[model samples]
Target chain A: GAGVSQTPSNKVTEKGKYVELRCDPISGHTALYWYRQSLGQGPEFLIYFQGTGAADDSGLPNDRFFAVRPEGSVSTLKIQRTERGDSAVYLCASSPTSFPQYFGPGTRLTVL
Target chain B: GIQVEQSPPDLILQEGANSTLRCNFSDSVNNLQWFHQNPWGQLINLFYIPSGTKQNGRLSATTVATERYSLLYISSSQTTDSGVYFCAVPRGSRLTFGEGTQLTVNP
Candidate 1:
């Protein structure tokens, strides 16, 4: 793809329901990242992947929040028992070898 | 964790005006970059300046790695330039973005 792509630009789910957000990064990006942004706040790191392995998952709020980049090209962020506080914009980004990252349009998930 | 802060959380400028936005980090960083998030929520990379100054036509950026700060300068602001500007730093494979400065350029 020409740029990073995220599915379900907007999502509205009932509390406690599980949801999965997907990301398709640039064709050859070696590093991928996921961020969460609340209204009026900057994006916060949720997880990072180097190839198919998750190099860091320290940013995940709790065990219920998980993400995986199985093939090194596409990634999925899974949330279990979603809470109303979980409502926010989920952002996915990718980078080749540099620190500069390219971001997706983001999925605005609303837990109601 | 790196503490990234940007000044003037909100900025309003008239078309053709010039302005500068500042970002400060609490810790040392190996790299820094700027991005412009449009109304549609697409983040577009603007600069990859860890140090020194780089200019791209009406826009320019300067980062003083030693001072742990960076500045983004917008010259001849246009209505289309109205958006949120974010500065992020390399924190391992992840980049920590600042709170972002929302710039509104009115024609």
Candidate 2:
């Protein structure tokens, strides 16, 4: 009955640095998704994984953003050479298939 | 990409009052969901009604898929209900969310 969980609830880093946000989905969930939310705005899709493979990653802003879920239950969103503009709350969600996504407490990333 | 629009960008209500939030999409969707983001910045799933109606306690949602709209009704709301309510529909394989309606419930 555990909901999704994210590590390092808050992270602060300098510009051009690298950071990784992890997500632990509910057991038996076969789909995972990543999203980013800026201040006073709705969350924007980042990437999604179905099982161990990323089913759709078009939402990833650029090549600097990459995510992986090799085992299908845990996924990590990695940012390379982070920019100040990349500062936001990174959210993760998991679902039985893709509808009714249950979200986790987002990891707020601050790029200073 | 489907466009989502929510009415009354902001709302103020007294605790124990009733209110309705609306969401309209530009295209038909097979999936529509409502979420509430609390002040602590946690996104909680409220409903996944793509059609018909569903209720959970004092909260209920109705989606008229053919009309491209959905409505969320809160009856006798509480102070804890104050937060940003969002409606999302899939755009491609990912969900596209609305600007969200910020609700303030005063006790």
Candidate 3:
């Protein structure tokens, strides 16, 4: 079976620019999540989606970060006016419901 | 919200050695997981033990929910086992990950 997959394994952009990272979850997974990881640190939760609606998004750092999981299978994390502080590896995971979430390869975003 | 802590922030070992990593949570959790983030930054699921014990190959995990802690054991580790090991527990609808333990296995 196919695991989770993320597009643009690496992305480099200038500060104040916008970038969108995509994630394809495993087949039949009803729950999805997004997280960000800085160097030498663990991943921090960004958003969680149960089905098409975001169940919890408190982890989103600010209003500039938004994520959508339309149709409950694919998700896109959008960063508006990105800042150098946003530079990190963006990770995505999916699960049937919760617990034991399977992770993707992640998209490394670099804000220069 | 729950606080998760990992012990022995950094560890170094020679190939074929065995080691144990621990994770302690401040509150009770219904879910707990262990992951290995490789050099390429891909997080690989190692165990999903919220309680009890389970083993896979040279890796095994045990979670004592009542004690609010989990332990991951790696036996006969190889250089490929060198990476960051993380433990995460669910808080509300999201996971709260610990800072992780950096493991370096030398050949």
Candidate 4:
């Protein structure tokens, strides 16, 4: 509505547990992106969606890390069998056609 | 896959001082942008410079895309400018961000 918004500002889950982070993009924005940022590092791209289909997923670290933007506005990043290394901040951003993107508050996922 | 590099990995400056940051990309890119991330982790947009130069207030940026590099200049810096500055390039429409320049402005 305002800017991009992500859910569960922080998440703590045990190893092997499953977690899902949500992202709500600005209304009518056609592009959505997911990224992971480890401490002391810049964000690494994970996946990008153009409308409801993923335009490029080559950045996803592994198959266990998956993202979906069904309907093109709201997206979800699902982690299966989470690992401790997966503990990092996940950020979501949305951009209108050819415009710079606006970021969300980010979800800090801590896998224990 | 474009490689983005930012120089002066870390910088410290006093209030009212001026500083410059740089970025070099590995390939031709259609979109380039600068972002500022506060210590609290909020990312704010700065500029989108793919070529030539542009200015906004005390902050200005220049991109020599033909040479695969960009520069960001901050004049009369303030403590409010203390944070990490990032340079990003659009790769096939997705942004690839650099490690960033950590700038600490002293009071």
Candidate 5:
């Protein structure tokens, strides 16, 4: 069975640029989550989606961060006007209803 | 928001030795999970024990919800176990993770 997977394992962008990270959840998973891991730090939650609607997004750092899962199986995390402070690894996870989450390999984003 | 704290912060163990990592939470939680992040930065789910105990191979975990703490035990450690161990709890639909315990097992 396929686990969660993220696209473009690595991404580099200049400050003030916009970038989008994609995630493909496991088959039949109805829950998707996004998190960010800074250097020497643990992963920080970002957003969560159940089905097509976002169930919780309180972890989003600021207005510049947004995510969507229109089809309920795939998700996209969008960042507006990238900042050097945003340089980190973005992780995606998926799980069945009330089950343990399975994580993806993550997409490392660098802002220069 | 809940506070999650991991003890020791770092540990160094010899292969075939046993070690235990602990995690403490500030409040009650509906979900608790343990994860292992390898040197390459890949996160692997180890256990999902909100309460009680569970074991897999050389790894075992016990969560005492009433005590607001969980312990992960690794027996007969191997060099491959060198990595970071994290404990997470759900806050709403998001997971709140601890800083993690860095483990280095030497051969």
Candidate 6:
């Protein structure tokens, strides 16, 4: 079985630019989540989607960060006017209903 | 928000040795899980024991939800076991993770 995966394993961009990270969850998964991990720290929650709707997005740092999981399988985390402070590894995970989560190899985003 | 803490922020072990990692939470949790982030930065799900115990090969985990803590034990560990081990608890619909215990297994 295929595990969760993310595209563009590494991305580098200038400050104030926009970037989008993609995630492909396992087939049949109904929940997706995004998180950010800074150096030497644990992952911080970003947003979550149950089905096609975002069930909880309180973890999103600000309005500049937005995510969508259309059709309940694929998700994209978008950052607008990115800042140097936003540089970190962006992780995605998926689960079935409310079970334990399986994580993907994160996309490392570097804002220069 | 529930606070999760892990002990021995860093550890070093020789291959074939045994070790135990611990996680403590500030509040009761309906969900608890352990994860291993390998050197390549891939997070692998290890266990989802909110209570009782579960084992996989040389790895086992026990969670005493009533006591708000969990323990992960590794027996006869191998070099491949070197990585960061994390424990997470649910907060709202998201998970709050611990800072993780960095393990280094020397062959």
Q: If the candidates were sorted by their DockQ against the true structure, best first, what order would they fall in?
A: 3, 6, 2, 1, 5, 4
lDDT of 6 at A41: 93
lDDT of 6 by residue, B1-107 (tens): 78999998999999999999999999999879999999999999999997999999999999999999999999999999999999999987688999999999999
lDDT of 5: 0.94
TM-score of 3: 0.98
Q: Which tens-of-lDDT digit does each residue in A1-112 have in candidate 5?
A: 8888999799999999999999999999999999999987889989889999998898899999999998888899999999999999999999897458889999999999
DockQ of each: 0.84, 0.86, 0.89, 0.63, 0.78, 0.87
lDDT of 4 by residue, A1-112 (tens): 5999999899999999999999999999999999888987888888989999999899898889889987879999999999999999999999997458788889999998
Which residue pairs overlap in candidate 6's backbone? none
In candidate 6 chain A, what residue range of length 10 has the lowest lDDT sum? A94-103
Candidate 2, CAPRI quality class derived from DockQ: high
Q: What tens digits encode model 5's per-residue C-alpha lDDT throughout B15-100?
A: 99999999999999877999999998999999999899999999999999999999999999999999999999987777889999
How many clashes in each structure?
Answer: 0, 0, 0, 0, 0, 0
Model 1: docking quality category: high
Question: Which model scores highest in DockQ?
Answer: 3
Residue-wise C-alpha lDDT for candidate 1, range B1-107, written one tens digit per residue: 88999988999999999999999999998889999999988889999998999999999999999999999999999999999999999777788889999999999
**How far is A41's C-alpha from truth in model 6 (Å)?**
1.0
In terms of lDDT, model 6 sits at 0.94
At residue B58, candidate 5 shows an lDDT of 98
Candidate 5 error regions (>4 Å): none
Residues A6-77, model 6: lDDT tens digits: 988999999999999999999999989999999999999998899999988988999999998878889999
* Model 3 stretches with alpha carbons more than 4 Å out: none
Native-interface RMSD of candidate 3: 0.8
Please write out the lDDT profile of model 2 over residues A1-112, one tens digit for every residue.
9999998899999999999999999899998999999999999998889999998998899999999998888999999999999999999999997888889999999999
What does the lDDT read for residue A29 in candidate 6? 91
